[model samples]
Target chain A: MNINLTPGPSQLFYTVPDHARHAFKEGITSISHRSKTFESYFQKATEGLKELLGIPTDYFIFFTGSATEVWEKSIQNLVENSSMHLVNGAFSNRYFEIAKQLGKHAQKMDAPLGQNFSSIPITNYGTELIAITQNETSTGVSLTNDFIREVREKNSEALIVVDAVSSMPYPALDYSQIDSVFFSVQKGFGMPAGLGVWAVNPRCIEKAESLLARGISIGSYHNLPTLLLNALKNQTTETPNVLGIYLLSCVVEDFLRIGIKKIRQETDYKAAILYQALRAHPLMSAFVKDESAQSKTVIVADCGEHSIRISNYLSEHGFNPGEGYGEKKKSQLRFANFPAHSKEQYERMVDLIENLR
Target chain B: MNINLTPGPSQLFYTVPDHARHAFKEGITSISHRSKTFESYFQKATEGLKELLGIPTDYFIFFTGSATEVWEKSIQNLVENSSMHLVNGAFSNRYFEIAKQLGKHAQKMDAPLGQNFSSIPITNYGTELIAITQNETSTGVSLTNDFIREVREKNSEALIVVDAVSSMPYPALDYSQIDSVFFSVQKGFGMPAGLGVWAVNPRCIEKAESLLARGISIGSYHNLPTLLLNALKNQTTETPNVLGIYLLSCVVEDFLRIGIKKIRQETDYKAAILYQALRAHPLMSAFVKDESAQSKTVIVADCGEHSIRISNYLSEHGFNPGEGYGEKKKSQLRFANFPAHSKEQYERMVDLIENLR
Candidate 1:
C-alpha cells in the first residue's frame, strides 16, 4: 500500500503471471547456464530490450550487475589513456571515481549541483572518451538529444558514453551517436533492481577487443567483450538474475502492449501535472535551474521552510516523497513518475503535498 | 513437471512465500539504491548469509553477479602475483582462462576427465593464491574437508578460495581456514542462480583494503569494499535481485527450521538412493573415479555406450538429468539432490532412471 516515490525502485504496473510464479516454486535451481529453457528467456529478453529501446540493429545490448559496474566496464574497455567526464550531479560524479579507480587518465568538466551540461563547450582535453549522465536523478536535470549530439561532435574521436540511469524510456535520448549507453533496470525500465542494461556500439567493442588483444586485462564479470559473446547467444557466462529476467520479459511485453510512444506521452503529461502541483504549492519551488533541462520523470524541488516536516507529512499521508539524493539532502525532495502511473495517482500525490503545504 | 537437473537453472525445490511475492509485486522494484529499504535488505542479506553459513563474526560476505564474477574479482583485487588452480572439471578449468585473461601468471594441477584433484602440491613460485572447486558438478567429485584443511595449513600464507557452488548448506565446510568461499544460491541453497554469495575472511578484506590503499582500483561493481560497506548498511550500491533476496530469506528461514544438520542427513539419504540405483543400472556407471570423492549433492554418471540416447529416454519418461558441462560435453548425465528434495521425489527419479535403463 506504500506509494513508492523513491527513484529507481519505482512502482511496477503489472503482476507477474501465475505460470512464472509456479516455475519459481518447484526447485529448478540446478539448471546450468546454457540450458535451453534459460536460453529461451535470455533470447526473448535481449530481443525485447533491443526492440523496446529502438537500439540500432548493429548495436548489441547486454545485462550486467549494475550501472556502477558498467561505469567501470566502459572505462576499462573504452578509455585508452584518458577520458573526459561531464559531472553535473551525484551519479555523474561517480564516473570520474570509477575512471580514476581503474587507473585511467580522466578529466572532469563539473557543473554546480542542480545544473546540467546541456551543452559542453568544445574542449581539446586529449581524451578518447567522454562520459555524461543523460538524466541527473539527484538534481532532476536532463541532457537532451541535441545536447548529446553536440557533445559527440565536440570530440569526434572521443567515444561518447551516456549514463542514462534515470532518463531512459521517458526523457528518451537518441543513442545513435553514443558509443555506449548504460542504465540499471530498476529505474527507467520499471523492473526490480539489480540488473544493469548496456548498449554498446561496434567502436566500443573494438576498444574491448583491443584491450584483450593487448595485455591490458579488464576484470571478468564487468568485461563487455566477454559478456557480448555470451549475450549474443542469449546467455551470460555468469549466473544471471533469472526471476528478474522473467519479470523484465513481462515488463517488456507490457511495454509493447502499450507502445513506447503512448508510454512516453503519458509519462510526459504525468510529469507536467506533478510539476504544476509542486510549483503551485506555496512552500516548494523547482530544484533544477532550467525548465528545458529538468527531468520529466523525476522532479527535484526545494521544500519551503519545513522540508523535513513536509516530507514526513507526505509520508504520513501515505505518499512517500524521496529525500534529496545529492548535496542538498535536507532542502530538496525527489518525486518520480514511472511509466504506467495514472493521472489520478499524481493528483492524489499533489493533494497530499498541498495538505502538507 | 520438468526435472531440471541441468546443474544450475536447476530445479527449485521450495516455494516462495506470499510476503516475498507481494513485496516483489508491490514495488520491490521501486526502491532506489539510496533508499533505506534496499539498504536494509542488503545489510540483512549479508548478515543472514553469515549466520546461515556459520561464518565467523570477523568475516564479511559480498554478493556478485555469479561465482564466475568472483573469479575475476579475486584476480583483480587479490592477485598481484601468480595463482595456483586445482582443476577437476569444467568450471575449475575456466579459472585458468580467467587468470590468463587478467594477465596474471597461473599454474594448474589438473585432474584427468572424470577424476578429482588428488593432490595440489603448492610451490613457492609466485603462488599468492590457490583456487579449488570444493564440489565439481561436472564430474560429481568433491574435495574432502581433511584435504582442504591440510592444503590450507601447508600454505597458510596463500589465500584459499573454494568454489562451493554445488556443496554449500550440506556437507558444509568450515569457513575459518578458507580465506574466501564463493557459491551461487541456485545449487545447494535451492534458490535461483543469479545471486553469488562470497564469505570473505578478514585476510581477504585486508587484501582488498591493501589493494585499494595501493591505488589498485578493482573496478566499481566488483569492488568488494564498496559492496561490503553498502551491504553492512543493508543497501546495495546498485539494484539487487530483490525478489531473489526475499526468496532467499524465505528459503533460509525454512532451512533454519529444518536445521542444516537434518537437511544434510536427508540429502545424504536421497543421494544414496540415486547412487544405489546408478550401481544397479547395467548401462550406467559413476563418472568419478573414487566413490569417496563423489558429490553427495550431485551424482555424475556415464551411460555405457549411448549417453544422449539414454538421457533422452529418461527425460521422455519425466526424468531430466544434467548433461556434462562445457568442453566435457555429452556422454554424461548428473543428478542433483538438495535439502528441499523429498524421499518420494528421489524414489520417483530413481525409478524413472531404472525403468529407462
Candidate 2:
C-alpha cells in the first residue's frame, strides 16, 4: 500500500473510501443543492464541525470554493481600506497580497523563514483587519495560542482573522478571542481539496454590513451577507462541492468518534517520533530551530543537499513525502502528520529517515 | 432506483460510479494539486473537453467554483465601462446583476419570459461586452445559432459571451463568433456540481490586460491573467475542485468515445418524445410557446395548477422532476434530457404524464 505524506491534499482518512462508496449508493452526487437531502448534509457538516472544534454558539459557519478563495472573500467583505498581516511564509504572504490586489492598503510584519513570532508586533497604522496564519505550511513554523491572544489583546478594534489552513482541530483555539477563522478541508481535515470552511462571529458580519451600508463594494454573490442568508436555510450562496462537503462531514464524524483528545495525543506521539529522528539523523535537522515554534502537524526538515535523494528514497519505499514549497523546493523535505497518518506510519517513516546514508 | 430530472446536479452518467471507485482505489483524492498526477488530470480534462466540444486551439479553458462565478469573472475581466445583455429569464438576469454589482454600467434588452428573439436588439450604448445565454435554464428558452450570429454581426467590437450553462456539446456553437463561453459541469456534462469551465479567446485576455495596465481593479487571485499564467502550466489559480475536474474528464472521454453526433441525436429523440407528450396531455403544455425557441436539453412544461400533484405523482413512480423555479413553482415541471438519460426512460416518463388523471 502506498503511504501519502504530502501536505494539503495529503492523506485520505481510513473512513473516506467507505463513506464515498456509501455516498454513491445513496445517490448523493445526483441530488439538487436545493433539495432537503443536501440541506441535511450541510447541517450535519456544520454541526459536526462545531462539535469537533468546540465552536461557540454565536459563530456562524460558511462554505466557499477553497481557502485561497476565502483569502479574497475576507478581504473583499471585511476590509474597506486597510489590513495588516503577520507574514512568515508563502501562505501568509499570499493573504497580504490578496488584500493589496483588491485595492486595500495592506501592510505586513515579516519574520524570516523557519522562525515565528512569540509576541504580536506593534503597528501604528490604522488597520481594519489583522490576519494571522496559525501554522505556516511552507516552513512548519507555528504561532502559539498565547501569541494569538496577545495579538487579540493588542488590536481590540481591528477584526482578527486566523488562517488555520494547515493546522485546525489540532489547535484548540479560544473562539471568544477570535473574530473569524478559515480552513480548507484538504489539510488538517484529511479530505479532498475543494471546500473551504469559514467560521465568523457577529463582529465580522457587522463589519461586512457596515462596508455594504457605506457603499463600499463587498463583492456580489457569495459575499458575507449572501452566504449568511443562504446558511440560515442550511444552504450555500452557490452550487457548492456537494461530494466534498459530504466527505468532510463523514471524516469529521469519524474524528469525533475517535475523540479529539485521542487524536491530539496521537498527533503529539507522531510528531515526537519524526522530530526525534530528525535530531538523531546525521544529514538532517529540524528546519524550525525553535522547538516550541515547530509545527506539530507539518514537520519540515533541512536536509542540506540530500533532500531530493531522501524524498526519492522514501517514495521508493511506498512513502510519498512533500518537497519544500516555492523557493525551498530543493533544500527541504516536508512530512504531514495528520489524523489519517497513524503512529506506526510515522515510526516506519522515521526508521527510514534515520537509516539514510 | 430514483430518476433524477433536476436541471443541475441531476442524474449521474452511468460510467461515473465505476470511474469514481477507480479514483478512490488509485488514491486520486490524496494527491497534491502541485503534483504531477494532478497536472496530468488537468491536461486530460482540457484536451478531452477540446476534443468533445470542438473547442478551437486559440481558446484557453479555465476552471472556477460555479458557472455563476464565471459571470462575475467575465464581467470583471472583459468589461471596462459597460456591458449589454440579452435577458429573457432568471439566469440571464443574474449575469446582468453580477455586472452591475461589480460597479459596471450594465444594460439589458428583455424578451417576454417564454419567447425568443429572431433578431438582435440595437443598443446605442458603447458597450464593451455583450452577454447571451444560449439556453436559459429558468424559462427553457434557447437562442438559435442564427440569432447568436446576428448578435455577433451587430456588435462587431464588443466581446460576445455565451452562457451554455444547461446546454453544451449539444448546441454545436460557432466558435468563431463567440469571444468567451462558460458552463457548469453538473448540467449537460452529467457530473457533480462545483466545477465551472470558462473558454476564453485572446480578445478577452487582451481586454483584461488593458484594464490592468490602466490600473483598474480587475479583482484578484483568480483573475484572467493569473488564470492564464497557470493554465499554461496545466494548473489553476487555486486548489480547485480536483475531483470534479477528474470526473468531467472521464465523462468527456465517454462522450468522445460515444461520439457527439450520436449524443446529439439521442438528445433530440428524448426531447421530441417529451415535447410530444406535453402537447397531447390534457393538463400540460410546453412552457416555451414557440417550438423553435424551446431548449432540447431542459424541457419545461406548464402543468397549470397541477404542478405539485404531477411532480408528486412522478416522484412516487421513481422519477424526480424539477419543481418550477422562483415564482413559477406551482405552475411548472422541468425535465432534463441529457445523454445520461435514455430514450426509454423519457418514453416512460412521457407515458406517465399522458395517463395522469
Best by TM-score: 2
How good is model 2 by TM-score?
A: 0.98
lDDT per residue as tens, model 1, A136-254: 87888887788888777767777899988876677456767788887877766666666788889899888888877777776665577778888878888678777667667777777
- The parts of candidate 1 lying over 4 Å away from their true place are A16-32, A118-120, A354-356, B17-19, B25-29, B32-40, B119-126
The DockQ figures for the candidates are 0.65, 0.82
lDDT of 2 by residue, B61-151 (tens): 9999998889988998998899999997999999999888888899998888788875445544468899999999988999887887877
Off by over 4 Å in 2: A119-125, B123-125
What lDDT tens digits, residue by residue, belong to model 2 across residues A1-357?
698898878788888889989988898998888889899989999999999999887789999899998999999999989999999799999999999998899999988788997544565446889998989999999988788787778788989899999887798998878899999888788777888999999999999999899988788887899899999999987788899888888888899999999999999999998999888888989999999999999999998799978988999998988889888889998898898898888888888888887
Cα shift from native, residue A306, model 2 (Å): 1.6
lDDT of 1 at A352: 74
lDDT of 2 at B118: 56
